[model samples]
Target: MNTFPIIETERLILREATCKDADDMYSYLSDKEVVKHMGLEPYQTSTDVLEEINWYQSIRKEGTGIRWGITLKGKDVVIGSCGFLNMQPRHYRTEIGFELSKLYWGKGIAKEALNAVMSYGYKHFELERIEALIEPLNSASQRLVEKQGFTKEGILRHYEYTCGKFDDLYMYSMLKAEFELG
Candidate 1:
């Protein structure tokens, strides 16, 4: 099993998601406003959040991906989740993704958590490229990645099926060299 290390920021902690975090995760995951642009529909119950949490744990154990629960430094509640997805060790690349509660939206919490995770990806995984796929309508997410120095590559038509339809997405990427330069 791979170890998931605790990552700390000035105001946040990125750590493993646990079953105990179900309620917190559900608070956001079940909110229509929060999951509007997400690939999955809003969860209907805390059990759904628990199942999602289990899935997150499974991927980490399988070494396929890593998801961290994002919490305020002094709080025990998780406000969001962020981490690498679809990690390809052979290609030295991975995709980054994050979702935060609407309550925390605009507070710079997501950026802080993602910065810590991205730094880990670059340093530990030695990733050549870190990519993000954002639904075209998710302006907040677009701005977040742009602020992190990810360059917009282009549109991927009908990129994913979600919420009963295919969604187009904008691809953003930051190469290892660019990350180092920035």
Candidate 2:
């Protein structure tokens, strides 16, 4: 299985998800406010959260991209999740996504987690391009990605179905070369 060692930052720990983390996952996933902008259903119960956690565990066996729970230093609670999705090995690229608990919003934790994950992709996975698709209405996420040096590629019309309707999305990308230069 692909091991996700704990990654420490100034104030957070990005680590693998464990079944024991179901409660933490439920804390965010079950909240409508947290999942409002995320393109997925709010988890209905801890059981649903556990099921999702199990799925994440299975992905490790495939040696592919997986999500990590973002935990604050000195605290056992998980405040968010960040990871790669839609991995395309042949293209040497993957889509990056993240969602944080509302309580931790605007604290720069998302950006820190994103930068760490991007660095891992570039250095360990040999990925050339990392892209983020943001709903046009999610200004916070757009700004976060931009600040992390992801250039706005373009707008994708009706790019995805979110919150029960088709939503326009902004595409952002950062190449390995660009990341290395900065």
Candidate 3:
């Protein structure tokens, strides 16, 4: 099993998810506004969040992905989540995803969490690239990825089936070399 040690930044901590985080996870993920731009459906209840936690736990056991709960430096509350999804070890790449509580938006927590994960992917997992598939309308996310040194690769037309329809997505990527230089 892949054991993810807690990663700390100037104002946040990225750590492995646990069942104990179900309520906190639900508090953010279940909010429609928080997940509106994310492709996944808004969680309906705490049990829904628990199921996600269970799924992440299983993935961790298989050493296929790393999922983290985002918490502030002096707080135990989980304000968001960031992780590698659709990890392709043979390809040396993985899709990155994140969600934060609406209240935490604009606080730069997402960027901090993302940087920590990208560093982990490069230095520890030996990943060559990290990618994010984002909705074109999500300018906030686009700016975040750009600030982290991801470049616009291309647009995948009608790429993801989300929110009851096919949505076009912008593909953003950061290479290990690109991240190292920035």
Estimate every model's Cα lDDT from 0 to 1.
0.90, 0.85, 0.88
Instruction: Provide C-alpha RMSD values for all models, in order.
Output: 1.0, 1.7, 1.4
Candidate 2: clashing pairs of residues: none
Clashes in predicted model 3 = 0
| Model 2, span 42-92: residue lDDT tens | 998888988777766766566556788999989988878898877888899
The candidate that wins on TM-score is 1
Ranked candidates, highest TM-score first:
1, 3, 2
Off by over 4 Å in 3: none
Point out the higher-scoring one by TM-score: 2 or 3: 3
C-alpha lDDT of candidate 3 relative to the true structure: 0.88
Give the per-residue lDDT digits (tens) of candidate 3, residues 1-182.
Answer: 43468899999988877888899899988888888898778898888888888877776777667788999988998889889888888999999989889999998789889999899889988999999999999999999999899999999999988778999999999999999999
Candidate 1 ranges with C-alpha deviation above 4 Å: none
Expressed as tens digits, the lDDT of each residue in 1-182 for candidate 1 is 64679999999988899988999899999998888887888999998898889878877877778999999988989999999889899999999999999999899999898889989999988889999999999999999999999999999999898878999999999998888887
Write down the TM-score of every candidate. Answer: 0.97, 0.91, 0.94
Better of 1 and 3 by TM-score: 1
